[model samples]
Target: MVFKCPFTMDCAGSVTSSCLVAEPLRSTGGREMLRVHFTAEDLTRIRIRAHPHPLWEVLLSLHLLQTRRGAAIFGPWRRDVRAALHPSGDILTTLAPPKGYSPDFLTPFVDSPELDDGLEVVLSTSSATLRADMTRLAEQTKLPSWAWRIAGGDAEMMRRLADRIRQYHAQALLPYAHVFKSHIREDWARRAEMAMTHGLEHVLSTLHPSIRWRAPVLEVDYPVDQDLSLDGRGLVLVPSFFCWQTSMTFADPALRPVLVYPVDPVIGWASHASATPDARSLEALLGRTRATVLRVIAEKPYLNTKQLARATGTTPSGASQHAAVLRDAGLVNTQRRNNSVVHSLSKRGAMLLDKPALQDRAGYPDIRLSNPSAG
Candidate 1:
């Protein structure tokens, strides 16, 4: 049975492909219901609005729309939002993160192990019923995979859909706005006081309802000194997804400072070291010509042979030879753009650049050594 979706069809012509799905009628009993789902692509799409730098408003809205509880609260009104945002299909993609920028940094606050466990407890108990309800809706809707493709071909539809989703989500968010607002307000009010004592950009408190019962969760950006000293107390760096923001713990006095990277930095660090060893080792492995080519591509992705040769002070033929060596080593990748071949890091190459080396330690075998040169 192929029935036209009452909602706008995404570029792929899937009626339910839109960001939110709204069900208008109830079955006999006076129960109202709606369903919302935010994919990783959706998060990136909304990020456009918050672009240039972090936009707290967009971040807060996205946080609510992406979570299970928030989806339940706003599900019924999704159609209204679709109407407002006029969403199309261009927002989704499988593109990996860019150079020097770690996607791990952008992960949400919930990614922490301690917080994840607490959230599981809440979902299994306090929010168990809501989860069940959403699961049912998910099964009933069963949107097709091709729906996401709609955005690729149509720009207008994409803009419209994005706008409508933003508006609708904003409307659905009103009731809970006050709660988050108060939380943000409390954070702002204490910012000055916390800064005076703790240092700049310290975590005022974690807003998760589960952990709020205990002490307000706190975080600090980069420590006051790069030496990783927090007045002799060890710091606990918590894993997180949100970029530029971190969750950390510090006591008043005495111990080694603990630095935590949001994602598993060990794997990333090792991969990076393996891919791009020190200049001398790299020169020895690939010879100076190939080594220079690797360095150029590592510094600037997507450079053509012409640009590569110029950058490396070599002829085009020499650069081409070196590029072949890199490609053979599986260290560099190339894409043909018209007549030009643009070179960039392959997955292996990127991982090598990003992953540092692991340290030998007791219990924490996964921890990577910060300095590869240190014994």
Candidate 2:
């Protein structure tokens, strides 16, 4: 069964084609009925693969939708996806091609025949299931009815609610940035500096000055081993918390010192102090055994209880307890296949993990006062 919008064109430019494939729930008066079941992961995968850009995967994973409903569903999904894809630390620090590796390096990986086949299968299955669910939902609730069944205002409303929830969360975690200060040191500091510089320069070059000023400019300083000059000009070192790198830029004497800060203490202070409540919520969620279970499922959507338990360092019984929590939270759905139970993060869970932290003031400790040099 399918519910296709007549107004839209298919890939072949045919307007009559059904864009949505819905499974029939029942037949009433010789008419097939159908429910809506689109998963956030499905939409995100589609969005990521739709683009051929080398950074599409990373960027798509980081793009946070602002609708309230989207936030509620997708926030947890984003964290889980992040854990699944790059659990070591940050995605940019882990998956980023080594320095000097161009975007072309990813072409083969992205374009592999096997990869394409897998993607097609996944998308097709998810899309079909979604369509069927949407159809069923439409049939069940005829309110705000359409000529052809489709995801309606309810879906949009859910997304909006999710976004608001995430916004609140982000705001909440912005204060904990100081707690993680000790985590940054030496090489980590240098890498963070570089990442911050790269991101800052990118944003500055692309955005209007007025718009750019609206966003806080995070500055960092790294102790210099020797006097460094680029093109006979003093160099400023900037660290990126996101990219985990230190970047040096040539600038006037006044601006040079302004940009540089001791990387280790600075990053530790900034990250811990600036951590928003939402970030804390996410961290707390991810800290749970259930979140770990969902992460495993997201990584390999078909894991048995033993496999999941091994991956998460838990006993089968513990894993079951965690799974129960996730199931109750609506973060995952389980299926009994033969003798094994297969678990996967729900669409909502997948979507939740994709959003970035929301807008909040990043807290910075009085490093100047703490350090005797400023006096």
What C-alpha RMSD separates each model from the true structure? Answer: 21.3, 24.1
What do the candidate models score in CA lDDT, each in turn?
Answer: 0.33, 0.33
| Predicted structure with the largest lDDT when compared to the true one | 1
Per-prediction TM-score, please?
Answer: 0.24, 0.25
For model 2, how does the per-residue alpha-carbon lDDT over 247-352 read when each residue is reduced to its tens digit?
A: 2221122221212111222323433342333343654865544544655555445567876675555678988888877777877778899999978767666566
| Residue runs of model 2 more than 4 Å from their true location after superposition | 1-279, 285-287, 355-375
lDDT of 2 at 74: 39
